[model samples]
Target chain A: MKINPEFVTSVITKFIREELNKFGFNRAVLGLSGGLDSTVCAFLAVRALGQDNVLTLIMPYGQTFPQDVEDAKAVVSLLQCRAMIIDIQPMVDAYFHRYPTDNPVLKGNKMARERMAILYDFSAREKALILGTSNKTELLIGYGTIHGDMACGLNPIGDLYKTQIRQLAIWLGVPEKIRNKVPTAGLWPGQTDEGEIGLTYEEIDKILFELVDLRRSRQEVIASGFDPKKVNLVWEMIKRSEFKRRMPPIIKLSSRTVGHDFLYPYDWDK
Target chain B: MKVVLVQFSPHLGLLDKNLDLHYQFIDRALEEKADLIIFPELSLTGYTLKDLISEVALNPRKNNQLNRLKSYSHKIDIVVGIVEEGNPGLFYNSAVYYSKGEILAIHRKVFLPTFGLFEEGKFFATGRNFKTFPTPFGQVGLLICRDFLHYGASYCLLAGKADLIIILSAAPGRGMSENSGFTSSEMWELMGAAISRFSTAFVLYCNRVGFEDGVVFAGGSFIYDPWGKCLLRGPDIEPAFLSLELELEDLRRARKTWSFLRDDKPEIILNSLQNLLAKNED
Candidate 1:
């Protein structure tokens, strides 16, 4: 379906409002990454829960680039949502110092989880639901940390793509600075999205829409005139991370299991 | 502060008998004056409800047993499974967060497992969104079995920012593992370990024990602190309760000591995760 952004926002806001009431909650919380997804979610949340009930946290590890911080502040200011910046460098440094791991990936992951911990702490105190900024692409690929950035009570953009977020960003009138900022995980200096992924989001999105939405097979995909390697690569990720999408395998000891047997989440009937 | 987890071997296709067992277990916890008491998933009704969930679902406004449990809420908070009427749906495996006096929260099972011998998808609909509820004693999160397995559950609780995650489970099998009779207990252990490590949230898992429909539950109720260290254990095949005291001071210290959620690199992971998402097809 070609969803109009306004229609989506209305449905999402309605979802948020009804969900909060249904679950006996009113407030919401989210980390403002100043990126397209979070920026878009911030605007959506402001519309959904009102700016006053929405608290945006900017968790910057000491090494965060100045622009990223500025952009985060810009989004919060433009959207008029409650925002705060919490420096996480000291906290992250302590873990590596104690364990002494040189693995940058592990350290980077540690940093991400720490940011979430702080967000949770704030949420704990604030009594708010964590609003997620993850879009469909990241969730499907298991791109976010398990409990870090991947953590949220509900994700608004988890079903959208990087390019889709960009579309929503422009539609929502996100500041040009944030909308145009080089997408980075902000792990270290001079790192960008293309550097790590080896393909631009534009190129990836077209492949994904066809594969995911159109349900095209590899031969069909290449037959349609795309690089075979890209098709193979994307398929491999889906095959590998398939576990991330479903419940972990549970050995059936009971007739019903939460994993393999009896499965359910809380408050589903509504 | 000590909590008792009763990993009971519930009778199959039995709700009234199982609830009677719940009363017995609660009485035992009260005998010990345990601060919190927990049970496995769907203990009130058998796990694999088929269609009986709708028939047996408790009407909170009318059900005497549920009301009795609500009255019991004043003594200790109970996290047990029950079927409740939900909007647009027939039944839910709900964790009625009740203390001795009143019901604190009602968490409908959201992640319906639909694979293998289990088929929750046939009955229960997944829950919407929820937050961690604050009790007088602590900030708590209630996630039914598979909910604990998903990143979504921890994310939701972590997003609500819960300090302690109580996973009321009916997880079966303790000795069987994947790939040619591997040990399933190890999987549960590793899962419990990873969940605690990742979220920095104290963890509690109460699994059922019994033999029904050829399914054997090895009741292994385990609790881990924020650092992924085991705090207590219960028998693998008994309708018994295990209790332990947790210091809020210790939790605060663990949060200070383990800063996993605070130091993250979101921008990079997001790119790597979604790189293919925006890709074009041939």
Candidate 2:
């Protein structure tokens, strides 16, 4: 779906400012992976809070691409915000050395969680909120690791689809090299998001825009010319990932449960 | 008559803080010498309050915060939104009209939207009536957010001979448009224009701005003349104070040129509704 980048930019910047200000935080920390999503978040965070207030952490594993690292550094220099490069290999390897495994998924998840741990650690170290970078497509398809890449104090781009984030990137004057680069999680060498997910963001976002946003049924989506297999796949992914989107369900023994009935706005009395 | 629209964000569940904000804006409006000032829906209690609704609900007849707001009306009229604690347990999303240091009228929101990002129906008691009250400016009719979407609600006000229809909303921004502004806001503007044109009443819409739990309120408030022409439009997604002097003559001229109100057939509609309801009961 098409979006007016200028309007999106204005609203998102305001959202960043207000969401942070309400929590008595003027600074933010985010894991900048040199990908389109994190880079866009970094730009918006800088625009909302000044460059001096945003801290970007580049956490790369041993197999992380060198170009991605360079791109992350380039973005930091371009935005002139604070940046720190912490090689996550030592921490990750230390954990895996005791319990070795070659499963890429498990190793990738460890890396993701490792980066998140550092982001939160610095979140307290700098007294800054953790800004999230997960896009709607990834979130909908269960592509992110829960409590890892999925965790954040506030998400500015969670509502935007991956395709829309690209559109926004162009409008925000993101570096052409990063914008045109093939999307990747940089979890391992030769890994691409589309290859791992088995669907391009363009295809996934279109399917999701119909299935989730427009609330189209599976048959209806298929009738609209999407492959039934892909539609079902996307549908299954959404249903499976529903748990990641919500807090852990609490068994209700009290009159009012925390998430079930004891509802209170997050910014209550702030 | 000069009217001021205060497009602001209210802190969630904080009555004293939001009341102080109202005083600041009222003071500013007084400095501008405006005849009336309006705030958005739940201006004193932020939207998206679930259990906090009861915690923030005010007893309009006895609350010190509301009385303080009423005191400001002695200098200039005030229209603000509040969670009115009705009977013992019934709480309504209500709008208060204060004039001459008294509570002139209260319009509890008739429509409580319950679907999709809104749980108002679960927390608020449904309002049962729509009535227009007299003010120094004109016969002013008040409606909350979802009430404005229901054309029949405005029709009731039109039937009551409302000269000015004021809508206070904390509508969240939804759906992106091709050019500018949210698509949901376009719907509000469309309704405002159609209502003003058909009823020949000055439509003044005041909407809030700011994010509450990630849902941003669209703040493109506006004023429309009786001819359905926009008099003033507020900024998008930002809090702003908008003021305009109403040309009361425009209302007279519009009503004269358009016979929509004069040739109205409320009796026929009422009789048909009576028959329909009778048949439904059968």
Candidate 3:
């Protein structure tokens, strides 16, 4: 479908406000990596809950780029929201030192999880909900850490594609430098999302729009001029990552299962 | 005529909170100068009230909770879904039309879906009739959620000379087609547009959003002109308010151009149904 940036932003801003209000929360918090997704989320949160109620945290590992940190600071300055920096190197390094591994993927997952741990502590202290910044493209193919970047009290941009997020970010007055920069999770040096995913967001979003949103068969997608191998590869990624999107399955011994038949309102007591 | 669709998620079993939100939306609609505002199915209570259905059931005459809503309707027309409490324990899933501080019409949902995720048939009594009432805008017809899915419901309203049809839905979104976004949302758009085109009447759809007992209602509230052109559309998963300026001339033009209603078919349908029912009885 054709996405209207203005309409999407307004809807997202209202969603953030209403969802948070339903949960009795007036404050919002998220890790700002100076990336397009976080920048857009921060801008929307400020619009929804106001600058005073939003808190942005910039957690940097030892291998983090200086420009990313500078960009995160610039975003806070522009948004006029409260921001703080916490060096996660000690926490990540302490764990790695005990285990001693050369694998960058393990280190990346640990770094991401460590940042979430710090964000949650701050969320408790400040009485705020952790706002997630993972976009639809990253979430669908398991491009993010499950218990790390995927955890959130509420997510404003989870449904939006990465390309759509950039459009929204530009519409929401995100700095040009941030919008134009290559997308990255800031997990490791020279690690771009597209480079790791093995496909450009524009291509992947089109494929996803056709395959998932359009509900076209895999053969149909392949017949639509896309490489059959590429289409099948994307389909496989979605199938494998299904577990990341759902809660743990319970043994259904009884008639009503916990997540199946047995369900309760999340705010039942409230 | 101007119509405003208030597409907000109502928390299950939260009567006070839902009523307060409705009041706020009413105030906002008045500020926007809407002639009528419509809410989703069971807006007062919620869609998934399995065992708690009777606990929050409202009686139009005695329930003081609706007093404020009645007062507001004096200024602008109001259409909302409610669990209508009747004769002690009897209850119904109904849509009430309020204007000038009076209950103009109440359309109890005729179709009580029992299959799949719906258990409405077990909770509320089925409605017996479908009616089009006189409104400041024009003759208007009302249908609740699944009621709109049945073609017979709309045919009755068309036969009654209704120029507008309002449907209140609490439908959960399903299926994500690659090009269409949400399959459920697109299906609704197609239905609303097709009904408006064939019936030559305006179609207003108001669906709720938010999670209720793990079921997320798709909020793609929209308004379509008689020509099947969408005037305004809302988001698929967010609470939104859409106010559109609807002129009666659109209906007049479509009816004049197509005259589908003028062709006549109710008598044929009535005769055919009789024969079909008689054969089934054997």
Candidate 4:
């Protein structure tokens, strides 16, 4: 389905402002990775909370590409917001030296966690709420490092698919260089999201629009000119990554446990 | 008949701004060649108006606020919700149907919910009439918000030979089902399906979105055919407009297959109700 970018921008900005006001905070902090998703989130945060109230923390590991850091700095300068870059190599090296591993997956997860650890520290120091950057596609397929890039006080782009993000980014007047660049987690060199996920975002978004929004069945999707293997693969990813979308399940020993039979809303007082 | 169901977020207590939006939606509908366009309850003024009800009430004679819409109805039929001024002190939550530069029918809300989050009964007078009027397509019935929640209202419309039932609601989104989401929207969908099938009439439900005083309106507007088949559905929690071409023949086909209206015994129902009222009085 086509979306009206003007309408979406107004509603999102209003939502961010209203939600922050309800929580009695006006400042927001976000990790600016120079990727499309984080750039879009930062843009919305700046619009909602103003440039003075927004702070972008550009934390990069030793292995991160220099071009990515430059792109992040360009965004900060364009928005005219406060920014700080903390080289995360020392922190990551300290931990990896104690628990040495040759696996890239382990190293990637460690770097992600280290960036988040520094982000939370700045969040506390600056008294700003942490904004999230993960999009719906990555969250659905478990492509993100949980408790790292996924941790945030609130997320503005989590509901938007990767294709929708591109549409919104252009509408929000995000720089074309960052918007047109390849999508990546920046966890390692030469790593791209679509390559690892084995599907183009255009192909996946259409399938996801049918699967998640329309709630179509697998056979229905396959019958609609989609390959059976891709449909099955995407469906499996969504099902398996369901845990990443929710809170940790609590063992309910009592009748009313948190997130169980008895529950209260977060804004009960307000 | 081609129909358009609109689900929009109205700014509370802003008549001029809301009318501008109404005109825009109407123009869009005209471009789509829609025969009829329906909007949510309180289309002119958002819901959750605690004390501003009287301030936003429109007088039928004095208020020319809807003249543009009435003129636009020369090419399309328009059904919208507005707060109406009755007497010096009486106001009503009402639905107005306009066609061919004239007000065809007005259905004041019969059920004014007062408990819980709703305070409509406290500020507005209840309607005493349930009627249907003729349109270019067929006989059409109108209900506002809580009126469609009561079964008797739909029965009255059916008894009046209405082939199309239109309801406007500002229902809030509440409760998430384990597998699905937005239970209230699902309930409204079920109501639309059942009413359309049982009465052998097309049902159109339009609900609004947006937040007012912390209450969020759930927007899942839809249009259903006589056989309980949904033709179009609006998005939830977002402002949306949907246009669909409906086959008027479906009413006749569904009635012929089921014959529910032909076998209906309204006289028996009226007599039983009268007898029960007499016994209660004695």
Top-scoring candidate (TM-score): 2
Pairs in clash, predicted candidate 3: A209-B178, A213-B177, A213-B178, A214-B177, A214-B178, A214-B179, A215-B177, A215-B178
Best-performing candidate as measured by DockQ: 2
* lDDT string, candidate 2, A134-182, tens digits: 9999898988999889989999999999999999999999999999989
Docking class of 1: incorrect
Docking class of 2: high
Q: Write the per-residue lDDT of candidate 1 for residues B162-227, one digit (tens) a residue.
A: 777888887765232112221555667787888887778789888876544434465668998888
CA-lDDT, candidates in order: 0.74, 0.92, 0.85, 0.84
iRMS per model, in Å, is 18.1, 1.1, 5.4, 11.6
Write the residue-wise lDDT of candidate 4 on B1-282 in tens digits. 789988987867778888899999999998898999998998897777756777788976567878888898898999988988978678889999989988999899999999876777877899999998999989999988788888889998888778999999999875433323366778889888888888999999999987665556778888888888888888777788888888998888899898888888889889988999989956
Q: For each candidate, what TM-score against the reference?
A: 0.51, 0.98, 0.77, 0.59
The runs of at least 3 residues in candidate 4 whose Cα sits more than 4 Å from the true structure, single-residue gaps closed, are B1-282
- How should the candidates be ordered by lDDT, best one leading? 2, 3, 4, 1
**Per-residue lDDT for A94-146 in model 4, tens only?**
98899999988898888888878888888888878888889888888888888
User: Cα RMSD for candidate 3?
Assistant: 5.5
Supply the DockQ value of model 2.
0.80
By lDDT, who's the top model here?
2
| Model 4 vs truth, CA RMSD | 11.9
